[model samples]
Target: MKRVLTTLSAALLVIACENSKGPELTGDKPPETAGDTSEGDSETGPDPDDPPVVTSAGPTTEGETDTGTTGDTTCSFVCDTTGGTGPDIQCDNWGQDCPDGQKCAAYANDGGFSWNALKCVPADAAGGEVGDPCTVEGNGVSGIDSCAFGSMCWAVDPESGQGVCVALCTGSPEAAQCAPAGTTCVVANEGVLNLCLPQCDPLLQNCESGDLCLPNPLDQSAFVCILDASGESGTTFDPCEYGNACDAGFVCQDPIFASECDPGAKGCCLPYCDLSDPECPGANQDCLAWFEAGMAPPGYENVGYCGIPQG
Candidate 1:
């Protein structure tokens, strides 16, 4: 399938600008510089205590080392595939500095620009394998722990501080490389990274006993296997701990629309519907706009959930 670059939301745009100095894994922001002090300089020469002006060599040129310095402070740009930067060292431009069998890949921080800084990573390494506990630490500034060559680590439940590493695959089911036999590659994020998940026909409601096949919020064409929420006894609405914690046929919606929910409190599990044939099983329930318009492939305006109609 064609790879579609993920769109940057307003929050992500702000992060991109804030992290323009380096890769998103390091989460490093540009340091604040002191105000100019030209008033104290003599007409004949320079000040004895003032810091020296430092200039960048501009964007790095091919095969040339780039350096930045201020006063006695000096930093050199270096490329190391292993990870991390040291005193006077910065990451190298992946395109220009990476060795053979390696490619420069950008993580997280995304905006109009290509990438702020490049990391030399194995051309085929995703960082971790499937079922591994995936996480990124150190504010994402220096380096990051990523999945293996053909996988991505996604948060399974924010509240539980749990995540799973899943293999990345094309939209074609035949190309899926999921383990344990029958799982298929589902379009977790259409045009972006597809994930290998257990297969089930939602219409038939025949899942692996305790699981339910539900349409994904990002892609209706694909379904995900989640714990059945139908057995939970509650009113029409109830708070949830995880995105899939609600009773069967309901999805836990976060109060804040984020790529990952905050720990402890996800939102309420609500019934979702197909806009093409909207339906609600309870009184005063109506299909309301869930995801915003144009957030995904079919457009956010076309996606909705069954809920109480607001006045």
Candidate 2:
């Protein structure tokens, strides 16, 4: 019985030893060596040595790098109220959102994405007519507005002689729908190039003999003489109710009848000598008789036979 029990104990001890070796064989791992470390890798996740990404706010083509963001844009609207040309889209340096005919341009508002309505600049020696539109670089004006940021030009009328600079709005060139001739909307200070002249009173007979009585260019309601500074009249005087240029010795005593003699003409000194006549109330009888008789003379129509002095 003793021997058999010893044999069972020995078998049990061998089984226990086998069970202990199983865990050592299955759970064991090789030791990490110094060569196992890599310079291009990180223990956390992705490698830090990778290149960075680039992006921009400006426009780009398809397949370009984009960070997935957007920007704003600006524009303008212009149209001719007159039945001339149709609406046109042009580029200019005016603020965005102007009335019709205005252009789009950069302004203080918005982040530089707007339109500016371009205006005509004044005409210089090289510029167009006073009423015609022009740009700063001497280009003809066409209404345009845009949203570009930079130095821009405007069309304007330059002043001449004595005329003032008058700004113009949209209108027809053939008619005064927008502005009068010789006048146009332009940059400031352009009116100095306009001609200066005296405005004649329309109520009076402003037309001098030989002077063309024309409508005032500045104010249509007024009258003005086309004659130059020298009072001499021109060959063709605008049709006056009654007037004509006179000889060198004659004066415009009655502008209504510019050439005909007044009652107190030197050829008829009696009128000048008449007591009731305010010109020469106290003329002598000899002077009066001589004046009347001179008028009757055949060749004395332009003769001087009065008390007045003649050079």
Best by TM-score: 1
Task: Give each model's clash number.
Answer: 22, 40
Q: Write the per-residue lDDT of candidate 1 for residues 246-279, one digit (tens) a residue.
A: 4445544432322233324424445556666788
On residues 146-236, what C-alpha lDDT tens digit does candidate 2 reach at each position? 2111112221112211111223333221132223443221111111001222233212324333232222222223322322111123122
CA deviation > 4 Å runs, candidate 2: 1-81, 85-164, 169-199, 202-213, 216-221, 224-234, 237-311
Scored against the true structure, residue 292 in model 2 reaches a CA lDDT of 30
Candidate 1 ranges beyond 4 A from true positions:
1-106, 110-127, 137-143, 156-162, 171-182, 188-190, 200-213, 216-222, 225-248, 251-280, 283-311
> After best superposition, candidate 2 residue 263: deviation in angstroms?
32
Instruction: Evaluate all candidate structures by whole-model CA lDDT and list the values in order.
Output: 0.33, 0.19
